[model samples]
Target: MQSEDNLLKVLIAEPSAIIRNGLSVTLKRIPGSWIQPVEISSIENLEHVLETNKPDVLIINPNFWGYVDMTTVRAWSAASKLKIIALVSSLSSDVILKKYDESISIYDSPEDIKEKIFRLFDTSDTEKDKSSEESETLSSREKEIVVLVVKGLTNKEIAQKLFLSTHTIITHRRNIARKLEIHSTAGLTVYAIVNKLVGLDEIKDNFTL
Candidate 1:
């Protein structure tokens, strides 16, 4: 177990409950228990949270910057180590994204979010080792499943295409989730594109599915 002093405090400032809750759920699934995430729906409450919570990381919407002065926030918390990450829900310009230490899209997978958070803090050896090990375990069949999944095929459809039982397909999906630490299809889609298993043009319309 990690000590309290070593805990990674994460403050999520998002207006949408759905997005805020989604990010909170994904962050909790990361390899370690040291992450303590707090959510707030309003940017107005951000300064108070920063003063009281003193979070190590802040995941916020880029639009919030228009309302709050980031420079003032940084000055107020200058004594502590604070990293700001943009929680992007829509297309943001390079100039806007450059203001953040890192940016995560709503479509990004749990694994991708984990990597970004880990990168920010220079995570421990145990977390890094586990991620490295999981990355190497996906079989060729799993890759095929991921491609079909990104292409917007249902489990039953994939089963029919692969000449396998739906039960077997479900089992394979469970194993894939365990191996990749990615439970959402959006994450799988991102993984497929990143690994070149599928082309963006092939799944552009169904990427959110």
Candidate 2:
């Protein structure tokens, strides 16, 4: 467990003062969490802060930045590998809140945001340990296979995507299972979800009977 004195360095990038203040206050109330809301007029400034701070996570609203320049957000997500949790208005239709090709985790209320922060920060240490062990056990090819499996891709689909024979994909799948001690796709999906190798929406969007 993280000590109360050791807080996560969080960067908040939102245009709305009310929402940003609310989130900052809520995070401060958490025992071992430090959230700094960046006071900026635009997304460009948010990227500057990220470049400087390299925070553990970023919380921002996509609408605040215009659609075309959203590439800046995607660049930050890829370059910094930041765990981005975006806020979206529930009133908006067709708002999927895709966080740079990854699924955006939604928070409908302050309570929901609080729950997510606790969940993300509380499990960080344990997950890091498990991730190290898991990484060591799988070969490069096996890791790729595991990622695809967690993405809920069938052997045939994975084969097509990877431009390999279905038989080869099947073999890789079996070897991955044996190496990871995961016996079924269901198990792999659960592992992926827990590990954030793939999001729930990505799995559901790709997986088909």
Clashes of each: 0, 0
Q: Write the per-residue lDDT of candidate 2 for residues 108-170, one digit (tens) a residue.
A: 234435545444444355487764344335445556777887776778998898788777666
Please list all clashing residue pairs in model 1, or write none if there are none.
none
Residues 74-128, model 1: lDDT tens digits: 7655336688888877645656666666677675557667767767666455686
Q: Quote the lDDT for 143 in model 2.
A: 61
Off by over 4 Å in 1: 65-67, 123-209
Task: Mark the 10 consecutive residues where model 2 has the least summed lDDT.
Answer: 99-108
lDDT to native, each model: 0.76, 0.58
| Global CA lDDT computed for model 1 | 0.76
For each candidate, give its TM-score against the true structure: 0.57, 0.45
Q: Highest TM-score: which candidate?
A: 1
